[model samples]
Target: MEEEKRTVRAVERALDVLLCFASRHEWGLTEIAGRVGLHKSTVHRLLATLEDKGFVTRDAATDKYRLGLSVLELSAHLFRSDDPSVVLLPEMEKLRDEISETISLYVRDRSERVRIQAVQSMQAIRRVATVGARLPLSVGASSKVLLAFANDGDRETVLADPSWPAQLDLQTFAKQLDEIVSTGYATSFEEREPGAAAVAAPIFNRSGKLVAALAVSGPSNRLTPDRMHEYAPAIIESAHRMGALLG
Candidate 1:
């Protein structure tokens, strides 16, 4: 009897060709072939198969191949299954209860901050920041917490924008970032919305990378300087605990 094959070299080669896109957005046939250590003919065949399966697409003019929507669909399903927002719900609820103020989780999105989750205060006189709301990173407490911990490249990207905070120059922004890093939190008094005040702390993953911001917000009258100073340590502690619970 003929010996059974333990592995298909062709399939492995095809997979290598696909993975070549991990570091590159697009590649020509020759470039992919070289990167995957496969012959040009082999890479071409693999690209044809991948394109047929909607895992890759070819640019007609540039003769390059790019990842296709199939990858996005797979990633979307994976992310939806274990959303970080799910972990945030209980922590945000705890914060809202502790402070009796609106609590929101914001993530950096390009040049802005997007509210991904929120728990409103129990009191009638409270501020309510809705989920799915997007605001500029230049003007809010939560946004600033994210900004303070952002990678240098990301911070520069935001600061380079024409709409960056008009009141703060580069030197002032750098100094403020230093302060936020030292304190591990930030505050904004009616900086984004009128009559609103918020205090925020950076939420890190288990790896100590900034992932999100947890903020307590309320009316400017109630979230006074004294109250902000009073609640800041609690907010920072909550952020620390919440980060420990994150995956």
Candidate 2:
């Protein structure tokens, strides 16, 4: 029993080492060990094991450690599952086909939103976002909708943090949130990423709580004010369909 517990601890430490890389582009052995609160030798051994498994890799020139391609491959496979993505895919595809723009599905994780699925548009010029990317709760249209519909305590926690990246003026953000709730959607132009514009609507479960957000993003030129207004109804319809499926 003691040995099993030790093994679990080791595995957790190894995972912690991997998670430590989340905030940085790359890190060295010493830095990783210090952040993970493990011995240098232990971290070195774990890193070696991960590298062998293609979960981490050592930079050829800098000798720093970065996430390996296998992690991305694994995440891609997970996204293709028949669970949430399967239920949402048809709706996402419908939105993509309707607007000929990229559609993304996101769910809130604690204080942030993570993109769980994306259907890239076939258009020659399009905005592209990865499947596992994380966005702050105060910036993009989807994030704002999520924030608006979140419980009061969660909303307060996210808005109270001065270090939050979006850093909108609190009073103004609060006012705009009311509009988002009233309309059941949100819109942003070149807010989070340059040259990208997006419109997002909230997905709710049978219990009438926000469960996810469906967003359509594309190049600013293509997703102009007129185009956004044109796409809003389709995006909202997709969100409603996804919410019903989830229910």
Candidate 3:
């Protein structure tokens, strides 16, 4: 068991190293060690293993590393597969184009919502969402929409979590969720971030299983509650199309 734990830890550290390249294209050994909070020697070992597997490539002249062809190959396979991210990205893009706001696809992961895919707005001032961001499922429009469609147990688990705001009225929140279910969309103003607002709708698979939440978000000045409500229908329509295509 101890050996297995060590192996898992090693794998996790290697993944952490790889994840550093998600924001930037390349990194030197010292920079990567600093970023991953690991020693330079340990990072070098992991980098060597990754390079051997063609997962990363090192530029000898600059002593910097970048993701290699294997990552692209895996991404290609993922896109070709029936992944929801690949299937729904087009619709998400369309919604972003129409509303001129950041569009995000989120799925509940335990008591948090994870953004798996996003199409950022082109506006000079807009909300920006990271693809792998994990946020509390207690405030944002997408969180509410997702929880509204979640099973009873999931909803209870989320509400029972201690991370929830102590001052929030659970009864009022439940009623708001019911309203969202009835209207097929939910809108929030400055619920998650101080200057961000969003509207979200649930995405259900063909079998009527809630699969994800589709959200349109932007700066509060641009996506006020009224403006978000005005765009709710378009967001809902796009989410429905994505769900249908999930088949």
Candidate 4:
């Protein structure tokens, strides 16, 4: 029984070391040990085990540790089933075809948003975003739509964080969120990435929980504000259809 308890405690300490790397740009062994409150030797052993498993890696030059590709591979495996790519690719393709622009799907992870799927139009002039891109919730139309539709607790938590990005003034952000909630959609110009405009709407499940966002994005020169306004209805309708399917 005592041995089992010791094993569980070791596992917990190892998990603490792993989690310490989550938000860091990179960390060395001493930093990881200090953050995890473990001795250097223990942390080194844990890191070595994790590195052997491909869950972490150390830079040869910098000697800093960061998450490894194997972590991403495992995450992708888990996401493969519930991934928005699996759920919304067909709709995104259709939207891209109809609008001649890029369509993307995003989901909220705490105060951040992650693009899980995207389909770029066949047009020679197009904006490209790779899958698995992460962005702050306060930046883009898609992220804002997800934030505005999120439960009140989540909204409050994100808004209350002092470290939250402050590119947009709180008053303006608040008012925009109110409008988005009222209209069930959101729009942005040159917010997330410069020279880009986007329109986004929320997807909900049968239980009425916001699950994801569907967005159409393009170069501002071609997809002007007027064009986004014209496309808003279709994007919202598609989100509704996707919500129903998720249900």
Candidate 5:
């Protein structure tokens, strides 16, 4: 039992060391040790093991550590394996063709939302959605849908985060989440980026667990509020279909 506890603790500490990089791109051994509240020798041992696994790299000249390519490689593997976005690519393409706007699939990553896949609009004037791009969970149609369907604890954690809009009223945000849950979709007008507009719907698994959000985004000039409302039904239907395929 003690051995098992030690093993779990070791894993937790290693993960803590890795997560420290989320705040900064690089870290020195002493800095990492202080951040994780571990001794320098223990941190060095953990870094050595992590380096062997290609999860982190140490600079030869500066002795600083940064995330390795293996992290991105693993993220790519995650997108290909059992990810609903990969399975729903055809649907996203069809939606893009139908709406003539950018169709993106977003998944919540802690307090952030990440675009896993995107089908860009063919028009010259359109919002560009890039895969693997991380956006704040505080705004945007996709972020609203992702947060609305999230568990209560996670929802609160994200909203209370220091990165969330300080001036935005929590009560109003709560009402917005409730509205999304009741309506089965969300729409945003220049909430995240000026001149960018989007409408999104939640995608769920066979177990009714919210998995990802399907968003149709474009320039406000083209995807106006009225047009977004018009596209809401199609986006909701496509999201439902995508969820069904997750089984």
Candidate 6:
């Protein structure tokens, strides 16, 4: 994020152009210039530089630009190099031991949330979420926090899905998501699985992008609505520690 504090206007303008591509796939010269509030000439120069570096590509017939293969390659590199579960296992184990509840780490995958890592509680009646288990975006504290903090485009993609709970209308769903963002956490009581209850907090990278959710789950008999609040501070603290390590 230090780069964002830079005095270089050229770098900032170029980055602004790249950000414009996140909301849309293709952009004409005029459209890109208008979005970034730069002159067409300046945008043209920036696009040429970005094109030379393989960060963007221009369509010959349509005279529009899209992200280039190099950008995809960079994204691939980031995924390959940034495996959070490996770095977070120790802290997760510590949290699990302290709380005596199942600790699960989930990341957003399209419109679903997938448990990428988990440490089960010792109790025989504890709730369990296996690694690689995909759960709906509409249910569970883990999934809701992911949806709540996701980028606007990703959030829209999940919201527009037919499976997003019909019981809650779009505006109601939006308000719930906004509440999660405001509170810094979310809770569920058998929303996804019978008798299960959970409290989840968002985990973010240093750049402030949410990367995952850390949740603690157990049987509703033990982790009832009243007791869920007791575990909130612990989960939120663990999320902060893990998120700081991510940076």
Indicate which candidate wins on lDDT: 5
Local accuracy of candidate 2 as per-residue lDDT tens digits, 1-247:
9999999998999899988876787999999989988899999999999999999999879989999998988877664443566788887887788789999988889778999889999999988868778888878889998998888898888888776755468899989998898987899999877898999999887678788888899899889978887878878877887878775
Candidate 4, residue 174: Cα displacement in angstroms equals: 1.2
TM-scores, one per candidate: 0.66, 0.78, 0.80, 0.74, 0.72, 0.66
Error of 4 at 121 (Å): 2.5
Q: Give the runs in model 3 whose Cα sits over 4 Å from its true position.
A: 34-37, 60-62, 122-124, 160-179
Clashing pairs in 6: none
Q: Give residue 71's error in model 2 in angstroms.
A: 5.8
lDDT of 2: 0.86
What's the number of clashes in each of the models? 0, 0, 0, 0, 0, 0
Candidate 6 residue-wise lDDT, 24-81, digit = tens: 7899999999999999999999999999999999999999999998898886655333
Which model, 1 or 6, shows the larger TM-score? 1
What's the ranking of the predictions by TM-score, best on top? 3, 2, 4, 5, 1, 6
For residues 174-210, what per-residue lDDT tens digits would candidate 4 score against the true structure?
Answer: 8889899998888899986789988999999778989
TM-score: model 1 vs. ground truth:
0.66
Measured on C-alpha atoms, candidate 3 has an lDDT of: 0.90
Cα shift from native, residue 72, model 3 (Å): 1.4
Candidate 4 similarity to native, TM-score:
0.74
Clash pairs, model 4 backbone: none
Error of 6 at 55 (Å): 36
- Alpha-carbon error at 183 in model 5, in Å? 1.2
For model 6, the run of ten residues with the poorest summed lDDT: 73-82
lDDT of predicted model 6: 0.88
- lDDT per residue (tens digit) for residues 1-247 in model 5: 9999999999999999998987788999999999999999999999999999999999999999999988988877675547676789999999999999999999999989999899999999988887878888888999999999999999999888888778889999999999999999999998877999999999998899999999999999889999999999998999888989897
